[model samples]
Structure formats: C-alpha cells, structure tokens
Target: MNEYFIDTNIFMYAAGKPHEFKEPCVSLLSRIQSGELKAAIDTEVFLEILYRYHHINLPDKGADLAWSMMDLGLNVLPVTKKDIEISLYFYQQYQDRGVLPRDIIHAATMVQNGLETIVSVDKHFDIIEEVKRIAPSDLI
Candidate 1:
C-alpha cells in the first residue's frame, strides 16, 4: 500500500520549468530520492522520457534524465510480452473513455506487478478499477 507506480507526468513536471504542478511534483520526487517513499516505473516511461526530450529537441537532456531515473534506485519494471497481452484487454475496455494506449500499458503493468496505486495527475486513470491514481500533491 505504500508503494506507487510513478507516471510520466511526475517526471515531466518535475523536470520542466515552473508550473502549477512543479512544486508538488518536486516534493514528491524528493521523497522518492530520500528513500522515504517507494516507487516504480515501467520501461515505457523510460522511453517516453526519451521521446519527450527528443520531441522538445533536448536529446542530451533526455538521455540524462533517463539515466537519472535508473540512478534514482527506483524499481524500473520491464514490459514483458505478458504485460502487453494484458494491455490489450484494458485498452478495449477503457479506450473510449479517454485512456490512452500507453496508459493502458501502465495499468497492465500495475496489474502484473501487484501495484494497486499510481502517482499521477492524469484523471483518466480513475476509470481503471484495478488501480487507484494518487496525485503527487495528494501524497505530499
């Protein structure tokens, strides 16, 4: 119950410049940094960080951030073939209600990993009954 599946937005918001969410996100990250909080992220989140940095024309920064995620000592879950198979089911169920394919994958990973809670700002995750979405602010 104390562990959480960290979402891409938490990293993105914490890395980007000032924003409404930056403070809470950073605070949550700090907790993670100190080993006071437990967290994990799927490999897709690693690639998404790379893609986002590439999309922003900051490939170097992206690489650094991706590496830093590994350095954070958080559990970086691999996306196994079985996880993708699970995603197919969640996608079919939640796609029409605003859940994206990547999120479905995240949800599937949660199910496979026995993680019932996620730390994220995405409201769409609320539609998935297998996991609960906790905002970074809420946890801090």
Candidate 2:
C-alpha cells in the first residue's frame, strides 16, 4: 500500500459541497476504508480543518467529522521538537517567498517523514518540491 499525507482541503471537499469532485473524493475515502492507501494527517491539518469548518459555521459537526476521520484510521503525525524547528526554519526561509504557517508545517511534516505525496487541493503545495500533490479530482 502506498502511504499518502492528507491535506485539509481534501477533507473539506469530501465533507462540503460544490460537489464537483464528489466521485474522486469518495474514491479516496473508500481507498482508506479498504486499507489500500495509508492516509497520514498532521496536527496542523487537523487544526486547520477544525478552524475552517467552524469558520463556516459548522462547529459541532466539524468536530464530529474530525473525530470520525481519526477513527477511520487516519494516522496522526505526532508533533516533535524537530518538526517545530523545521517549521520555524521554513517560516523564516519562505516568509518573503509567500509561505503560510500551516503550509510550512505540512511540507515540513512530509520532509521529516520522507513522504512525497500529499492529498490536497491547495496550490500552496505547488511551491514545495518535497512532495507530489495529488488532489481529489485525480482520484475521481
């Protein structure tokens, strides 16, 4: 099974509507269910998902969804001192290069783990070379 780190947008798309990528999103979830693909999610992605979902007024349900993903076997990457240090380094290095804190954390998580694929719809990953970004549409 190939392991992939999930970015927050994939979850949002799977949960929210615009419904353009519904099939692909469902396929990704199904892959996780069958254990063909190992899905990794970091604390930063978790916080972003909660914040964005609540920001859109889905407070109670957003939290419920977050917990559900965890229960569904999404591996939560533990935050370590090294992860923080790398994040800080990226914050300074990419500050003028237009990097967001959350993105830096995500990229750094991939770097630390030697993972190269990210399941995300966010284009910020395009700026990072450490991972290959796979969006929900690709799965569809």
Most accurate candidate by lDDT: 1
lDDT value for candidate 1? 0.91
* Model 2 CA deviation exceeding 4 Å by range: none
What is the per-residue lDDT of model 1 for residues 55-86, given as tens digits with 9 covering 90 to 100? 98999999988887876768889999999999
- CA lDDT scores, all candidates in order: 0.91, 0.80
Q: Summarize candidate 2's per-residue lDDT along 7-102 as a digit string, tens digits.
A: 887777777776776567767987886787788888887788789878989888889878878766888897678988888988887777686888
Clashing pairs in 1: none
Candidate 1: count the clashes: 0
Candidate 2, position 27, lDDT: 78
| Cα RMSD for predicted model 2 | 1.7
Worst 10 residues of 2 by lDDT: 17-26
User: Against the true structure, candidate 2 has what lDDT?
Assistant: 0.80
